[model samples]
Target: MKHLLYLFMLALPVVATAQKDSLAGAVQATRPLPLYRPGFALMLSAGSTGGGVAVGYSVSRSVAVRVGANLFNYDGTLKSGKDTDDIQIGFDYTVKLKNADLMVDLYPFKRSGFRLTGGAYYNINTVTFFGKPTKDVKFNDTVFTIDEVGTLDGKANFNKVAPYVGLGFGNPYTRKRLKFMVDIGFFYQQSPLVTFRTTGMLEPSSDQGSVIQKNLEPLKYYPVVNLGLSYKL
Candidate 1:
C-alpha cells in the first residue's frame, strides 16, 4: 500500500499536465464541450476506526460527497488490586464498536491532486463492553463464586453526532474510471459514557463504575487512516 501511494503521488504531476493539455484542445474547438462532472464511485476505507464501503458522487471538480458504515471489536481480561482481605478481582470481557458518516470533500487547488475534507455525520460510533468475573470474589469476608458475584457489563457511548476533518490524495472527483486515494483524519467526539455495573448476583452497594468511566475518558476522539479504490460512473 505504501509503495502504491508513492507511485500515485509521483504520477499526479504528469496527470495534471496531460489533463491540462486536453482541456486546452477542448477550448480551441468551436463545439461545446461534453459535461465531465457529476460522476459516481464505489470506495472502501480502513483504519484504527475500522473498515467500510462507501458510495460517492462528484458534484464538481472541487466538490464530492460520500456515506458509509464500519465496525470494530476487541476483547481481553482486566484486573484490579487486592482488597483489604487480600483477595484479587478480575474479569474477562469483549467490546464491539460501530460507526457511520456522511462526508464532503473539497479540493482547493484548481489543478493539484490534494483534497481537503470536512463534514458532519450522524455518528453512531460506540463501544459495547461486557465481562464476567475471572474467579471467586470475596465480599464481607465471604468468598463467593463468580456466578454468585454476578457478571459485569456496560455500554460506552460517544456523541451521536460529530464533525470530521481529513486530507487525501486523488481529487475527490477523479477523472479516471478507476483511481486510488489515501486519507488520514479524525472525528472529534465528546467524552464516552461508560455505564457499567454488576448484574444478577451479589451486587456491590458502592458506585464502583466511576473508576471505569474515568479510565475511558481518553477515547473521546477517533482517528482514521484510509486507502481506497474508486471507480467513477
Candidate 2:
C-alpha cells in the first residue's frame, strides 16, 4: 500500500505535464523544465504569536521544497497570552500538485523567461506547556486541573504535513538578482492526550483528550500564507 501511494505521488507530475505539453502548445509547452530558483522567506501563522524563518532553493520551474520553523499554538485556547508557549520545528515537501496557474502565466504576458513555484511540506510539531494549569483551580479530590493534564499530553505532542502552492512574478531576464512574492497555504497538527494531576487534589480529575479537543477547536487550517524576498544565484 505504501509503495502504491509513493508510485501514485511520483506519477502525478508526469501525467499533468504530459497533458499540458500535448495540447496546442499550452503553458507547460512554452516553459522550460528543471528551471531553478532559490530564496528565503519569513513565515507567520495564526497558530502562534511570533513568526518563523525559512531558507531553501528550488530545483524546478513549477515546484520547490523548503524547510522552516515557527511558533504555533495547536489549540485555539493556547494561542492567547497565557496557557503554554509551544513551538514547532519541521521540514516541508511540496509538489506543484496543480499547474493550472502555470498555464495562466504563459498567456497575456509575452515574457518567456520566468519561474513559477508550488509544492507541499511536512512539519513536525513539538510543544512545551509552561508549568501546570490546575495548581490553583480546585476540583474536589481531583489532584490535577483538567487544563494542566491536557497540556501535559494533548498540547505538547504532534506532527503536521501540509501542501502549499506559490506563484512567482519577476523577470528571469534579469538573471537571479532580486524578486518579491507573497504566498498563502494551509496545514494541520494533532496532539495525543496525556493525563496529569493537580497539586492539591487527590483524585485524577482531568482528561487530556477532552481538554485538548476543546482547546484546539478554534484553530482551523486555511490559507497558510507566506511573504518573502528571494535572491537567486
Candidate 3:
C-alpha cells in the first residue's frame, strides 16, 4: 500500500505537466496569425495602360501607398474608304501611352483580398498621324495626282493630369512573400486636342481638326485592366 501511494504521488507531476503542455499547444493553435505588418514591396504589372513597375508601402492592414509608371507604344497604318467629300485616304499613325501614378489602396475587409484604389496620373499620351491619298483623286472635277492631293500631318494630345479609380484583388503585405494581383479601373483624361497642318491641295483640311476632336470625345475615359506580381521587401 505504501508503494502504491508513492507511485501515485510520483506520477502526479508528470500527468499534470503533460496536461499543461497540451493546453498550451491548443491555445497556440487557436490564436490568429498576424495579417498585416509594416513593410515595403516591389510590383511589376502589365495592362491596358502598358507595362509598369511600382514601389508600395503598407501603412497598416487597411491602407497602402504606391508610386509607379507605365509605357506602351504602337505604330500602324489604316485605310479609309470614300469620305463625305468622296476622298479615300490612308494613314500612318503612332500611338504613345506614357504615365506616372501616385495611388492609395484601401482594404475594407480584415481578411479579404479585395481592395479599393484611387489615384492621380501624370499623363503624356499622344497620337501622331500622317494621311495621304491612297489613289489618284478628283477635286472640283479636276483629276489630281497623289502629290497634288497633298497630305495631312497631325498630333492628338490629352489632358496632362488624370484622376483614376479602381478595385483589385490580392494583398502584398499578407503572410505570403509573393502574390498575384488584378485591377480593373478607369482614368479620366478628358477630350483629345488635335492640331494639324496640310500641304498642297489639302491645305483647307487643316481646319477639320475640330471634327477629329469631336470624334474622340468618347475616349475621355481610359480603361485599365492590370495583372501583376508583387514581392514583399
Model 3: per-residue Cα lDDT over 122-172, one tens digit each: 999998999999888776898999999899989999999999999999999
**True-structure lDDT of candidate 1:** 0.72
Candidate 3: clashing pairs of residues: none
Higher-ranked by lDDT: 1 or 2: 1
Tell me the spans in candidate 2 whose CA falls farther than 4 Å from its real position. 1-118, 130-154, 165-176, 190-197, 217-223
Better TM-score candidate (1, 3): 3
lDDT of each: 0.72, 0.40, 0.91
Clashes of each: 0, 14, 0
The local lDDT score (0 to 100) that residue 223 gets in candidate 2 is 47
- Alpha carbon lDDT of residue 7, candidate 1? 100
- By lDDT, highest first, what's the ranking? 3, 1, 2
Candidate achieving the largest TM-score: 3
Candidate 2, after superposition: displacement of residue 164 in Å? 3.4
Tens digits of per-residue lDDT for model 1, 1-233: 99999999999999999999999888787564343446788887676766778888877877888887777777777776654434445655565557778888887886676888897656666566656656676668888886776677677777888888988887535445666878788888878877766765635732866777777777776677888777676
The candidate, 2 or 3, that scores higher on TM-score is 3
Ranking by TM-score: 3, 1, 2
- Whole-structure CA lDDT of model 2: 0.40
Models, CA RMSD each: 14.2, 21.0, 4.9
